[model samples]
Target: MDTLRYELVFSEGTDSGSSAGDVVTVERTSATGPGGHPVYTDPTGIIRAEISDQGEVRVLATGGHQDPAQGVRARPLPDAEERS
Candidate 1:
């Protein structure tokens, strides 16, 4: 959806150069759930990623919370992930 977004963090890689470290991100969205609302992540998610030369995104690690399910608290756009 247009309202949803992912906040990404890029770090320098050892070999991959610029394309590397293009996958670390946190997705945020508004929602109503047992977690009280504004669940940060889906029920399950990928923690790490491995991008290929063809630009294919590969999930390296996965995790989730059973009860709350939310990964973070909702905050202001400027304080949190910002879109250009």
Candidate 2:
């Protein structure tokens, strides 16, 4: 399978002192999500994403949110990691 590459958009509060709309590169972890989708995490570990094979991105907030499941939605930036 081709490596899944993507970036995460971090908003204020999710990342302390960082400005809103900050983008960060994400690396796939050993974890899996629903239907065994690939789970990715940023360097800060503040954000987690499960991206479907069909390109659907599900944001999982590790912290900084009242409801962890109600993480800020984000679109997968295909190949965004290459630019990092």
The candidate that achieves the highest TM-score relative to the unseen native structure: 2
TM per candidate comes to 0.23, 0.56
TM-score of 2: 0.56
Report, for every candidate in turn, its global Cα lDDT versus the true structure. Answer: 0.35, 0.66
RMSD of each: 12.4, 6.3
Q: Clashing residue pairs in candidate 1, if any?
A: none
Best by lDDT: 2
- Which regions of candidate 2 fall more than 4 Å away from where they truly are? 9-21, 67-84
- Candidate 2 residue 65 Cα shift, in angstroms, is 4.0
Global local distance difference test of model 1: 0.35
Candidate 1, residue 67: lDDT: 30
User: In candidate 2, how many Å is residue 61 off?
Assistant: 2.5
Report how far residue 81 has shifted in candidate 2, in Å.
Answer: 13
- In candidate 2, position 74 carries an lDDT of 46
lDDT of 1 at 71: 26
